[model samples]
Target: MLKHAPSSAWFRSALPVLVAWFSLSAGACGLYSLPPLEEQKARILSDQITLRALTAQAFLEAWGEPTYSHSEPMQFFPVASGNYIPRFRVPLGESPPGWDDSIVSEQALFLGYADRGELLGFLEKRLIYREHLPAEQIHAIAAQWKREELFKTRLEAPPARPPSP
Candidate 1:
């Protein structure tokens, strides 16, 4: 009569082979390292043609991470005014130009890929704009944001104590 092994013994004997197979398969499937960033960018650009609408999560998955991300409040002028004014314009009186007493603002997220020379803007987690800018322009935009952030930080910081003479 042939003798049968216990379940525990069979499991113990097969464990090492199973582990080796899983490890080898994982490595071959690229679980150990990420693909090149340039390849990811190319894929994103190509995929975007068919995927006109992309969510923030989808963007992160495809682009990995942005070089810089900035969130700013966006103000819209009433369409009935028949004219549109830039946001930078100072309000002549208490309210902004083309803006009524009730002001509406929406938060927008801007993602910059300096290396890829791409700028993407998202509104409410949905991509609203994409542009292929020159690297210099991308750098300039990043520098401008840095300056603004520094200025904001200084303004919020406590006043420095004057040194005694």
Candidate 2:
């Protein structure tokens, strides 16, 4: 014959409920992380990535195709177009060419880089935020980038033609 300790009896009774609660909580929090785009860019720059060597195929293999792909007319040089200027987390200086200059110092985070349909490099400028971004938030930011690009594309026009040369 065996006797249960009072505490042991209590723990046994509570174990299932606690386990269930923990399982639900963990699932609710989600189990995914997005790579920190800013940090990755820094690493690439620090490594002195040879942009010319990178190709669209290799880039796609590494990072996966961007959630969105689009181009914008070069504001300073209107004759130039067809470059795949990827969307960014933070807009670079004078980007969108006439937007307010506030927060222009924070460098843009390019999700992809290609020109004339060839990958030259990805990511445009350095980050202002030096702190380590939580990995989990990266997915969210990536999703946000997709959303922003889709919205912009739907709402904006193709780069305007240079005034009839």
**Candidates' TM-scores?**
0.47, 0.26
- Estimate the Cα RMSD of every predicted model relative to the unseen true structure: 17.5, 19.4
Best by TM-score: 1
Clashing pairs in 2: 34-139
Identify the runs in model 2 with alpha carbons over 4 angstroms from their true place. Answer: 1-48, 62-134, 153-165
Model 2 Cα lDDT, one tens digit per residue, 41-124: 444446433322233333344556644343332222111121223234336653543333222121223332322122232222
lDDT value for candidate 2?
0.38
Question: What digit string (tens of lDDT, one per residue) describes model 1 on residues 4-69?
Answer: 856998999999999999995664232554335455455566864211135555567776688888
Clashes within 3 Å, all models in order: 0, 1
Tell me the lDDT of model 2 at 118.
23
Q: lDDT (0-100) at residue 73 of candidate 1? A: 67
